[model samples]
Target: MSNDQLAAVFNAGIREFDRLTPQVWGPAGQSLITQLRLRPGDAVLDVCSGAGASALPAAAAVGPTGLVHAVDVADDLLEMGRLVASDRALHNVDFVRADATEWEPPSTVPAAGYDALACSYGIFFLPDTDQSVNRLVRLLRPGGRIGVTVWRRGALTDFARAYADVLARHLTGPAPSRTDASPLSRFDTAAALTDWLTGFGAHSVEVTELSNLLPATPQLAWDLILGGAMRAPLLGLDDDTVESIRRDFLSLLTERDVETLDATTLVGTAVVTG
Candidate 1:
Protein backbone atom coordinates (compact mmCIF):
# COMPACT_ATOMS: atom_id res chain seq x y z
CA MET A 1 0.00 0.00 0.00
CA SER A 2 1.05 3.57 -0.58
CA ASN A 3 2.00 5.79 2.35
CA ASP A 4 -1.25 7.69 2.14
CA GLN A 5 -3.23 4.47 2.10
CA LEU A 6 -1.31 3.03 5.04
CA ALA A 7 -1.64 6.30 6.90
CA ALA A 8 -5.39 6.15 6.49
CA VAL A 9 -5.44 2.63 7.85
CA PHE A 10 -3.38 3.84 10.80
CA ASN A 11 -5.69 6.79 11.30
CA ALA A 12 -8.68 4.49 11.45
CA GLY A 13 -6.97 1.67 13.34
CA ILE A 14 -5.61 3.67 16.28
CA ARG A 15 -8.80 3.34 18.32
CA GLU A 16 -8.66 -0.45 18.20
CA PHE A 17 -5.59 -0.31 20.40
CA ASP A 18 -7.55 1.52 23.06
CA ARG A 19 -10.60 -0.72 22.79
CA LEU A 20 -8.51 -3.87 23.21
CA THR A 21 -5.87 -2.33 25.44
CA PRO A 22 -6.59 -4.25 28.62
CA GLN A 23 -6.40 -7.71 27.02
CA VAL A 24 -3.96 -7.15 24.17
CA TRP A 25 -1.49 -4.76 25.74
CA GLY A 26 -0.87 -6.07 29.24
CA PRO A 27 1.24 -8.98 28.06
CA ALA A 28 2.83 -7.11 25.16
CA GLY A 29 3.83 -4.22 27.39
CA GLN A 30 5.10 -6.49 30.13
CA SER A 31 7.07 -8.67 27.72
CA LEU A 32 8.66 -5.70 25.92
CA ILE A 33 9.59 -4.01 29.18
CA THR A 34 11.06 -7.21 30.51
CA GLN A 35 13.05 -7.77 27.32
CA LEU A 36 14.44 -4.25 27.40
CA ARG A 37 15.14 -4.50 31.12
CA LEU A 38 14.17 -0.84 31.37
CA ARG A 39 16.01 0.84 34.19
CA PRO A 40 15.30 3.93 36.22
CA GLY A 41 16.31 7.15 34.41
CA ASP A 42 16.56 5.42 31.02
CA ALA A 43 15.63 7.48 27.97
CA VAL A 44 13.50 5.31 25.70
CA LEU A 45 11.78 5.89 22.36
CA ASP A 46 8.62 4.03 21.37
CA VAL A 47 8.14 4.39 17.60
CA CYS A 48 4.61 4.16 16.27
CA SER A 49 3.35 4.22 19.81
CA GLY A 50 -0.36 3.80 19.32
CA ALA A 51 -2.30 5.08 22.36
CA GLY A 52 0.72 5.11 24.63
CA ALA A 53 0.38 1.43 25.46
CA SER A 54 4.12 0.94 25.55
CA ALA A 55 4.86 4.50 26.61
CA LEU A 56 2.83 4.33 29.82
CA PRO A 57 4.62 1.24 31.01
CA ALA A 58 8.03 2.57 29.99
CA ALA A 59 7.33 5.77 31.90
CA ALA A 60 6.56 3.77 35.02
CA ALA A 61 9.72 1.74 34.58
CA VAL A 62 11.92 4.76 33.95
CA GLY A 63 10.21 6.77 36.71
CA PRO A 64 9.92 10.57 36.94
CA THR A 65 13.54 11.22 36.07
CA GLY A 66 13.63 9.39 32.76
CA LEU A 67 12.01 10.17 29.41
CA VAL A 68 9.78 8.30 26.96
CA HIS A 69 9.27 9.64 23.45
CA ALA A 70 6.16 8.19 21.83
CA VAL A 71 6.15 8.74 18.07
CA ASP A 72 3.52 8.03 15.43
CA VAL A 73 2.36 9.34 12.03
CA ALA A 74 -1.22 9.72 13.23
CA ASP A 75 -1.96 12.96 15.08
CA ASP A 76 -5.16 11.58 16.55
CA LEU A 77 -3.26 8.64 18.00
CA LEU A 78 -0.63 10.99 19.41
CA GLU A 79 -3.36 13.03 21.01
CA MET A 80 -4.64 9.92 22.71
CA GLY A 81 -1.13 9.26 23.96
CA ARG A 82 -0.93 12.80 25.29
CA LEU A 83 -4.18 12.32 27.17
CA VAL A 84 -2.96 9.08 28.65
CA ALA A 85 0.25 10.70 29.86
CA SER A 86 -1.70 13.62 31.28
CA ASP A 87 -4.16 11.39 33.11
CA ARG A 88 -1.31 9.56 34.75
CA ALA A 89 0.65 12.73 35.50
CA LEU A 90 3.55 11.08 33.73
CA HIS A 91 6.02 13.94 33.35
CA ASN A 92 8.62 11.74 31.70
CA VAL A 93 6.83 10.92 28.45
CA ASP A 94 6.64 13.08 25.28
CA PHE A 95 4.51 12.38 22.22
CA VAL A 96 5.66 13.25 18.70
CA ARG A 97 3.46 13.21 15.62
CA ALA A 98 5.79 11.98 12.85
CA ASP A 99 6.40 9.08 10.55
CA ALA A 100 8.94 6.65 11.96
CA THR A 101 10.32 5.77 8.53
CA GLU A 102 11.47 9.37 8.00
CA TRP A 103 11.76 10.79 11.52
CA GLU A 104 14.77 12.97 12.33
CA PRO A 105 15.73 12.85 15.95
CA PRO A 106 15.74 16.14 17.86
CA SER A 107 18.82 17.51 19.65
CA THR A 108 17.64 15.85 22.84
CA VAL A 109 18.13 12.48 21.17
CA PRO A 110 21.64 12.69 19.80
CA ALA A 111 23.25 10.32 17.31
CA ALA A 112 23.33 6.90 18.93
CA GLY A 113 21.84 8.45 22.06
CA TYR A 114 18.85 6.72 23.56
CA ASP A 115 19.19 4.16 26.29
CA ALA A 116 16.81 1.91 24.31
CA LEU A 117 14.20 1.93 21.55
CA ALA A 118 10.92 0.07 21.02
CA CYS A 119 8.46 -0.42 18.18
CA SER A 120 5.82 -2.73 19.54
CA TYR A 121 3.69 -4.17 16.74
CA GLY A 122 4.51 -0.99 14.88
CA ILE A 123 7.38 -1.79 12.50
CA PHE A 124 5.23 -4.02 10.31
CA PHE A 125 3.23 -1.05 9.02
CA LEU A 126 6.20 0.83 7.60
CA PRO A 127 6.47 0.61 3.83
CA ASP A 128 10.23 0.24 4.14
CA THR A 129 10.98 -2.00 7.08
CA ASP A 130 14.77 -1.91 6.70
CA GLN A 131 14.96 1.87 6.52
CA SER A 132 12.60 2.28 9.47
CA VAL A 133 14.58 -0.24 11.47
CA ASN A 134 17.77 1.66 10.74
CA ARG A 135 16.17 4.93 11.81
CA LEU A 136 15.00 3.37 15.07
CA VAL A 137 18.44 1.89 15.60
CA ARG A 138 19.97 5.34 15.15
CA LEU A 139 18.04 6.63 18.17
CA LEU A 140 19.64 4.10 20.49
CA ARG A 141 22.88 4.61 22.39
CA PRO A 142 25.72 2.27 21.53
CA GLY A 143 25.08 -1.06 23.19
CA GLY A 144 21.48 0.03 23.68
CA ARG A 145 18.74 -2.39 22.69
CA ILE A 146 15.87 -2.43 20.21
CA GLY A 147 12.69 -4.46 20.49
CA VAL A 148 10.20 -5.20 17.70
CA THR A 149 7.12 -7.38 17.25
CA VAL A 150 5.34 -8.66 14.13
CA TRP A 151 2.46 -11.02 13.47
CA ARG A 152 3.86 -14.54 13.12
CA ARG A 153 1.51 -16.32 10.70
CA GLY A 154 -1.95 -15.77 9.31
CA ALA A 155 -3.05 -19.29 10.18
CA LEU A 156 -2.12 -18.61 13.82
CA THR A 157 -4.01 -15.28 13.68
CA ASP A 158 -7.55 -16.54 13.06
CA PHE A 159 -9.27 -13.19 13.53
CA ALA A 160 -6.87 -11.35 11.24
CA ARG A 161 -6.95 -14.12 8.63
CA ALA A 162 -10.72 -14.26 8.71
CA TYR A 163 -10.91 -10.51 8.29
CA ALA A 164 -8.43 -10.52 5.43
CA ASP A 165 -9.97 -13.51 3.68
CA VAL A 166 -13.41 -11.94 3.83
CA LEU A 167 -12.10 -8.73 2.37
CA ALA A 168 -10.08 -10.58 -0.28
CA ARG A 169 -13.06 -12.53 -1.58
CA HIS A 170 -14.93 -9.37 -2.53
CA LEU A 171 -12.26 -7.49 -4.46
CA THR A 172 -12.88 -8.04 -8.18
CA GLY A 173 -9.28 -7.22 -9.08
CA PRO A 174 -6.27 -9.22 -8.07
CA ALA A 175 -5.70 -9.12 -4.35
CA PRO A 176 -2.57 -7.20 -3.42
CA SER A 177 0.34 -9.39 -2.45
CA ARG A 178 1.37 -9.01 1.14
CA THR A 179 4.69 -7.45 0.07
CA ASP A 180 3.01 -5.08 -2.36
CA ALA A 181 0.09 -4.13 -0.17
CA SER A 182 1.16 -4.76 3.40
CA PRO A 183 4.78 -5.63 4.12
CA LEU A 184 3.74 -6.43 7.68
CA SER A 185 1.70 -9.29 6.35
CA ARG A 186 4.57 -10.70 4.35
CA PHE A 187 6.83 -11.80 7.20
CA ASP A 188 4.54 -14.60 8.32
CA THR A 189 7.21 -17.23 8.23
CA ALA A 190 9.82 -17.69 10.98
CA ALA A 191 12.61 -18.07 8.44
CA ALA A 192 11.59 -14.91 6.60
CA LEU A 193 11.42 -12.98 9.85
CA THR A 194 14.78 -14.28 10.98
CA ASP A 195 16.45 -13.26 7.73
CA TRP A 196 14.82 -9.83 7.81
CA LEU A 197 15.91 -9.07 11.37
CA THR A 198 19.42 -10.35 10.89
CA GLY A 199 19.81 -8.43 7.64
CA PHE A 200 19.10 -5.18 9.50
CA GLY A 201 22.44 -5.53 11.33
CA ALA A 202 20.85 -6.71 14.56
CA HIS A 203 23.38 -8.45 16.79
CA SER A 204 22.57 -10.85 19.57
CA VAL A 205 19.18 -11.05 17.97
CA GLU A 206 16.78 -13.27 19.85
CA VAL A 207 13.50 -14.39 18.34
CA THR A 208 10.56 -15.67 20.33
CA GLU A 209 7.01 -16.62 19.34
CA LEU A 210 4.48 -15.22 21.79
CA SER A 211 0.80 -16.09 21.98
CA ASN A 212 -2.16 -14.61 23.88
CA LEU A 213 -5.92 -14.92 24.22
CA LEU A 214 -8.21 -12.12 22.98
CA PRO A 215 -10.55 -12.59 25.93
CA ALA A 216 -13.53 -12.08 23.61
CA THR A 217 -15.80 -14.02 21.27
CA PRO A 218 -15.54 -13.98 17.51
CA GLN A 219 -18.53 -11.64 17.32
CA LEU A 220 -17.04 -9.39 19.96
CA ALA A 221 -13.75 -9.52 18.09
CA TRP A 222 -15.49 -8.43 14.90
CA ASP A 223 -17.23 -5.72 16.88
CA LEU A 224 -13.86 -4.43 18.08
CA ILE A 225 -12.66 -4.21 14.47
CA LEU A 226 -15.89 -2.55 13.38
CA GLY A 227 -15.67 0.00 16.18
CA GLY A 228 -11.99 0.73 15.70
CA ALA A 229 -9.14 -0.34 13.36
CA MET A 230 -10.97 -1.64 10.35
CA ARG A 231 -13.45 1.22 10.11
CA ALA A 232 -12.01 2.81 6.99
CA PRO A 233 -11.48 -0.21 4.71
CA LEU A 234 -14.68 -1.62 6.11
CA LEU A 235 -16.55 1.60 5.29
CA GLY A 236 -15.61 1.21 1.65
CA LEU A 237 -17.29 -2.20 1.41
CA ASP A 238 -20.89 -2.58 0.30
CA ASP A 239 -23.38 -3.70 2.93
CA ASP A 240 -24.00 -7.03 1.21
CA THR A 241 -20.32 -7.84 0.89
CA VAL A 242 -19.67 -6.80 4.48
CA GLU A 243 -22.44 -9.01 5.79
CA SER A 244 -21.26 -11.93 3.74
CA ILE A 245 -17.74 -11.62 5.12
CA ARG A 246 -19.08 -11.35 8.64
CA ARG A 247 -21.27 -14.40 8.28
CA ASP A 248 -18.48 -16.41 6.74
CA PHE A 249 -16.05 -15.36 9.45
CA LEU A 250 -18.53 -16.16 12.21
CA SER A 251 -19.17 -19.61 10.82
CA LEU A 252 -15.43 -20.23 10.56
CA LEU A 253 -14.73 -19.21 14.18
CA THR A 254 -17.78 -20.73 15.88
CA GLU A 255 -15.56 -23.45 17.24
CA ARG A 256 -13.11 -21.05 18.91
CA ASP A 257 -15.91 -19.74 21.12
CA VAL A 258 -15.65 -16.86 23.61
CA GLU A 259 -11.99 -17.07 24.47
CA THR A 260 -8.86 -15.21 23.62
CA LEU A 261 -7.98 -16.04 20.01
CA ASP A 262 -4.68 -17.89 19.90
CA ALA A 263 -2.77 -14.97 18.40
CA THR A 264 0.99 -15.22 18.00
CA THR A 265 3.62 -12.55 17.36
CA LEU A 266 7.27 -13.06 16.51
CA VAL A 267 9.27 -10.79 18.80
CA GLY A 268 12.89 -9.94 17.99
CA THR A 269 15.37 -8.03 20.11
CA ALA A 270 18.93 -7.03 19.32
CA VAL A 271 21.54 -4.54 20.44
CA VAL A 272 22.64 -1.77 18.09
CA THR A 273 26.19 -1.98 16.85
CA GLY A 274 28.37 0.56 15.03
Candidate 2:
Protein backbone atom coordinates (compact mmCIF):
# COMPACT_ATOMS: atom_id res chain seq x y z
CA MET A 1 0.00 0.00 0.00
CA SER A 2 1.07 3.57 -0.58
CA ASN A 3 1.84 5.98 2.27
CA ASP A 4 -1.50 7.75 1.94
CA GLN A 5 -3.43 4.49 2.11
CA LEU A 6 -1.53 3.47 5.22
CA ALA A 7 -2.26 6.80 6.88
CA ALA A 8 -5.91 6.68 5.89
CA VAL A 9 -6.30 3.18 7.29
CA PHE A 10 -4.82 4.18 10.63
CA ASN A 11 -7.01 7.25 10.78
CA ALA A 12 -10.09 5.15 10.14
CA GLY A 13 -9.22 2.81 12.99
CA ILE A 14 -8.22 5.50 15.46
CA ARG A 15 -9.86 4.05 18.55
CA GLU A 16 -8.68 0.48 18.04
CA PHE A 17 -5.19 1.68 17.16
CA ASP A 18 -4.82 3.54 20.41
CA ARG A 19 -6.57 0.82 22.39
CA LEU A 20 -3.85 -1.65 21.41
CA THR A 21 -1.19 0.60 22.90
CA PRO A 22 -1.31 -0.73 26.44
CA GLN A 23 -0.73 -4.29 25.31
CA VAL A 24 1.08 -4.04 21.97
CA TRP A 25 2.65 -0.71 21.08
CA GLY A 26 3.27 0.58 24.62
CA PRO A 27 5.55 -2.20 25.78
CA ALA A 28 7.62 -2.08 22.62
CA GLY A 29 7.94 1.70 22.91
CA GLN A 30 9.12 1.46 26.53
CA SER A 31 11.54 -1.27 25.61
CA LEU A 32 12.91 0.83 22.75
CA ILE A 33 13.43 3.76 25.11
CA THR A 34 15.12 1.60 27.71
CA GLN A 35 17.29 -0.16 25.15
CA LEU A 36 18.32 3.17 23.72
CA ARG A 37 19.29 4.17 27.28
CA LEU A 38 18.30 7.78 26.74
CA ARG A 39 20.08 10.36 28.85
CA PRO A 40 18.80 13.55 30.39
CA GLY A 41 19.12 16.59 28.08
CA ASP A 42 19.25 14.32 25.04
CA ALA A 43 17.30 15.29 21.96
CA VAL A 44 15.19 12.59 20.29
CA LEU A 45 13.26 12.19 17.06
CA ASP A 46 10.64 9.45 17.21
CA VAL A 47 9.31 8.55 13.77
CA CYS A 48 5.99 6.75 13.20
CA SER A 49 5.18 7.54 16.80
CA GLY A 50 1.43 7.00 17.13
CA ALA A 51 -0.18 8.79 20.08
CA GLY A 52 3.21 9.39 21.62
CA ALA A 53 3.69 5.86 22.84
CA SER A 54 7.48 6.05 22.67
CA ALA A 55 7.67 9.81 22.29
CA LEU A 56 6.02 10.53 25.64
CA PRO A 57 8.38 8.26 27.48
CA ALA A 58 11.26 9.72 25.51
CA ALA A 59 10.29 13.24 26.57
CA ALA A 60 10.16 12.19 30.20
CA ALA A 61 13.47 10.38 29.85
CA VAL A 62 15.10 13.50 28.45
CA GLY A 63 13.40 15.49 31.20
CA PRO A 64 12.91 19.29 31.22
CA THR A 65 16.21 20.05 29.60
CA GLY A 66 15.67 18.14 26.36
CA LEU A 67 13.19 17.86 23.50
CA VAL A 68 11.44 15.22 21.42
CA HIS A 69 9.96 15.51 17.95
CA ALA A 70 7.39 12.87 17.14
CA VAL A 71 6.50 12.64 13.45
CA ASP A 72 3.84 10.62 11.65
CA VAL A 73 1.74 10.74 8.49
CA ALA A 74 -1.66 10.62 10.17
CA ASP A 75 -3.00 13.93 11.45
CA ASP A 76 -5.63 12.32 13.66
CA LEU A 77 -3.04 10.11 15.30
CA LEU A 78 -0.78 13.12 15.72
CA GLU A 79 -3.69 14.94 17.38
CA MET A 80 -4.02 12.00 19.76
CA GLY A 81 -0.34 12.28 20.55
CA ARG A 82 -0.66 16.03 21.19
CA LEU A 83 -3.60 15.46 23.50
CA VAL A 84 -1.72 12.87 25.48
CA ALA A 85 1.30 15.12 25.72
CA SER A 86 -0.91 17.93 26.99
CA ASP A 87 -2.56 15.76 29.66
CA ARG A 88 0.83 14.52 30.78
CA ALA A 89 2.20 18.09 30.78
CA LEU A 90 5.01 17.12 28.48
CA HIS A 91 6.23 20.44 27.13
CA ASN A 92 9.25 19.01 25.42
CA VAL A 93 7.63 16.81 22.82
CA ASP A 94 5.98 17.98 19.60
CA PHE A 95 3.97 15.48 17.58
CA VAL A 96 4.12 16.66 13.99
CA ARG A 97 2.09 15.40 11.06
CA ALA A 98 4.68 14.58 8.46
CA ASP A 99 6.13 11.73 6.45
CA ALA A 100 9.04 10.05 8.14
CA THR A 101 10.33 8.80 4.82
CA GLU A 102 11.06 12.40 3.92
CA TRP A 103 11.52 14.00 7.35
CA GLU A 104 13.89 16.88 7.79
CA PRO A 105 14.81 18.63 11.00
CA PRO A 106 13.68 22.22 11.29
CA SER A 107 15.84 25.03 12.60
CA THR A 108 14.76 24.32 16.15
CA VAL A 109 16.76 21.11 15.99
CA PRO A 110 20.37 21.31 17.13
CA ALA A 111 22.98 21.93 14.46
CA ALA A 112 24.71 18.72 15.43
CA GLY A 113 21.44 16.77 14.88
CA TYR A 114 19.34 14.65 17.23
CA ASP A 115 20.98 12.75 20.07
CA ALA A 116 18.79 9.69 19.44
CA LEU A 117 16.16 8.36 17.07
CA ALA A 118 13.42 5.77 17.53
CA CYS A 119 10.57 4.03 15.73
CA SER A 120 8.38 1.26 17.12
CA TYR A 121 6.76 -1.29 14.83
CA GLY A 122 6.91 1.12 11.90
CA ILE A 123 9.56 0.77 9.22
CA PHE A 124 8.31 -1.71 6.68
CA PHE A 125 5.69 0.79 5.57
CA LEU A 126 8.31 2.93 3.90
CA PRO A 127 8.76 2.58 0.16
CA ASP A 128 12.43 1.76 0.53
CA THR A 129 13.22 0.63 4.02
CA ASP A 130 17.01 0.74 4.00
CA GLN A 131 17.28 3.94 1.97
CA SER A 132 14.69 5.78 4.04
CA VAL A 133 16.32 4.71 7.28
CA ASN A 134 19.68 5.86 5.98
CA ARG A 135 18.22 9.32 5.36
CA LEU A 136 16.81 9.44 8.90
CA VAL A 137 20.12 8.31 10.31
CA ARG A 138 21.72 11.34 8.72
CA LEU A 139 19.56 13.47 11.03
CA LEU A 140 21.45 12.07 14.00
CA ARG A 141 24.79 13.34 15.19
CA PRO A 142 27.86 11.18 15.21
CA GLY A 143 27.83 8.50 17.91
CA GLY A 144 24.09 9.06 18.37
CA ARG A 145 21.88 6.02 18.73
CA ILE A 146 19.00 4.77 16.55
CA GLY A 147 16.45 2.23 17.66
CA VAL A 148 13.50 0.48 16.03
CA THR A 149 11.12 -2.31 16.95
CA VAL A 150 9.93 -4.92 14.45
CA TRP A 151 8.10 -8.22 14.58
CA ARG A 152 10.33 -11.19 15.27
CA ARG A 153 10.23 -13.97 12.67
CA GLY A 154 7.17 -16.20 13.04
CA ALA A 155 5.60 -13.79 15.48
CA LEU A 156 1.79 -13.78 15.38
CA THR A 157 1.81 -16.70 12.93
CA ASP A 158 -1.36 -18.37 14.15
CA PHE A 159 -3.28 -15.14 14.56
CA ALA A 160 -2.36 -13.80 11.12
CA ARG A 161 -2.81 -17.13 9.38
CA ALA A 162 -6.35 -17.46 10.66
CA TYR A 163 -7.13 -13.95 9.51
CA ALA A 164 -5.67 -14.68 6.07
CA ASP A 165 -7.69 -17.85 5.69
CA VAL A 166 -10.87 -15.96 6.43
CA LEU A 167 -9.87 -13.05 4.22
CA ALA A 168 -9.01 -15.34 1.34
CA ARG A 169 -12.50 -16.80 1.48
CA HIS A 170 -14.05 -13.32 1.42
CA LEU A 171 -11.78 -11.69 -1.15
CA THR A 172 -10.18 -12.71 -4.44
CA GLY A 173 -6.78 -11.04 -3.97
CA PRO A 174 -3.80 -12.17 -1.91
CA ALA A 175 -3.92 -11.74 1.85
CA PRO A 176 -1.26 -10.57 4.25
CA SER A 177 0.79 -13.29 5.90
CA ARG A 178 2.46 -13.54 9.28
CA THR A 179 5.17 -15.88 8.10
CA ASP A 180 7.59 -16.19 5.18
CA ALA A 181 7.40 -13.94 2.07
CA SER A 182 5.88 -11.01 4.00
CA PRO A 183 7.60 -7.65 3.63
CA LEU A 184 8.61 -7.85 7.29
CA SER A 185 10.61 -10.99 6.65
CA ARG A 186 13.42 -8.90 5.19
CA PHE A 187 14.85 -8.20 8.62
CA ASP A 188 12.74 -10.25 10.98
CA THR A 189 15.64 -12.21 12.40
CA ALA A 190 18.41 -10.79 14.60
CA ALA A 191 21.16 -11.73 12.19
CA ALA A 192 19.31 -10.20 9.24
CA LEU A 193 18.55 -7.02 11.17
CA THR A 194 22.17 -6.74 12.34
CA ASP A 195 23.48 -7.19 8.83
CA TRP A 196 21.03 -4.62 7.47
CA LEU A 197 22.23 -2.06 9.98
CA THR A 198 25.88 -2.85 9.36
CA GLY A 199 25.28 -2.61 5.63
CA PHE A 200 24.53 1.06 6.24
CA GLY A 201 27.70 1.47 8.30
CA ALA A 202 26.03 1.42 11.71
CA HIS A 203 28.08 -0.24 14.48
CA SER A 204 27.59 -1.86 17.84
CA VAL A 205 24.28 -3.28 16.64
CA GLU A 206 22.23 -4.96 19.33
CA VAL A 207 18.91 -6.77 18.93
CA THR A 208 16.77 -7.44 22.01
CA GLU A 209 14.05 -10.01 21.97
CA LEU A 210 10.71 -9.03 23.52
CA SER A 211 8.55 -12.09 24.03
CA ASN A 212 4.89 -11.00 23.99
CA LEU A 213 1.83 -13.21 24.23
CA LEU A 214 -1.73 -12.58 25.40
CA PRO A 215 -4.86 -14.63 25.81
CA ALA A 216 -7.00 -14.78 22.65
CA THR A 217 -9.95 -12.98 24.09
CA PRO A 218 -12.69 -12.17 21.62
CA GLN A 219 -12.19 -8.44 22.02
CA LEU A 220 -8.40 -8.58 21.48
CA ALA A 221 -8.73 -10.87 18.49
CA TRP A 222 -10.85 -8.36 16.62
CA ASP A 223 -8.97 -5.30 17.83
CA LEU A 224 -5.63 -6.57 16.56
CA ILE A 225 -7.18 -6.92 13.12
CA LEU A 226 -8.87 -3.54 13.18
CA GLY A 227 -6.06 -1.56 14.82
CA GLY A 228 -3.33 -1.76 12.19
CA ALA A 229 -2.46 -1.96 8.50
CA MET A 230 -4.18 -5.33 8.48
CA ARG A 231 -7.44 -3.42 8.19
CA ALA A 232 -6.38 -2.02 4.83
CA PRO A 233 -7.91 -5.00 3.09
CA LEU A 234 -11.28 -4.62 4.75
CA LEU A 235 -11.66 -0.94 3.87
CA GLY A 236 -14.05 -1.01 0.93
CA LEU A 237 -15.85 -4.18 1.93
CA ASP A 238 -19.45 -3.82 3.07
CA ASP A 239 -20.38 -4.00 6.73
CA ASP A 240 -21.82 -7.49 6.54
CA THR A 241 -18.80 -8.80 4.70
CA VAL A 242 -16.41 -7.28 7.19
CA GLU A 243 -18.48 -8.61 10.07
CA SER A 244 -18.55 -12.06 8.56
CA ILE A 245 -14.82 -12.02 8.10
CA ARG A 246 -14.34 -11.01 11.72
CA ARG A 247 -16.66 -13.66 13.08
CA ASP A 248 -15.13 -16.35 10.88
CA PHE A 249 -11.62 -15.31 11.80
CA LEU A 250 -12.43 -15.57 15.49
CA SER A 251 -14.11 -18.95 15.03
CA LEU A 252 -11.09 -20.22 13.18
CA LEU A 253 -8.92 -19.22 16.12
CA THR A 254 -11.05 -21.32 18.46
CA GLU A 255 -11.11 -24.28 16.05
CA ARG A 256 -7.33 -24.16 15.75
CA ASP A 257 -6.99 -24.12 19.55
CA VAL A 258 -5.10 -20.89 19.31
CA GLU A 259 -5.06 -19.78 22.92
CA THR A 260 -2.44 -17.05 22.69
CA LEU A 261 -1.66 -14.10 20.41
CA ASP A 262 2.06 -13.91 20.02
CA ALA A 263 3.40 -10.41 19.44
CA THR A 264 7.02 -11.24 20.07
CA THR A 265 9.21 -8.39 18.75
CA LEU A 266 12.78 -7.43 18.06
CA VAL A 267 14.13 -4.16 19.38
CA GLY A 268 17.20 -3.37 17.29
CA THR A 269 19.66 -0.61 18.05
CA ALA A 270 22.97 0.62 16.69
CA VAL A 271 25.36 3.51 17.13
CA VAL A 272 25.94 5.83 14.13
CA THR A 273 29.59 6.68 14.29
CA GLY A 274 30.12 9.23 11.58
Best by lDDT: 2
Weakest lDDT window of 10 consecutive positions for candidate 2: 174-183
Q: For candidate 1, what is the TM-score?
A: 0.82
lDDT for each of the candidates? Answer: 0.71, 0.90
Model 2, span 46-84: residue lDDT tens:
999988889999999999899999999888899999998
User: Candidate 1 lDDT, tens digit per residue, 1-274?
Assistant: 4555555765766656566677665467667777778899888988878777778889999998888888877777778888988998998898887777776667766455888888887776676677768766776788888887676676235566555665677666643333335676555566776677667666777777777645557545765565444544665777887787778767656654525565566776777774
TM-score of 2: 0.97
User: What's the TM-score of each model vs. the native?
Assistant: 0.82, 0.97
Task: Pull out the clashing pairs in model 1.
Answer: 1-181, 13-229, 213-260, 214-260, 214-261, 215-260
Cand. 1 Cα-lDDT: 0.71
lDDT of 1 at 69: 87
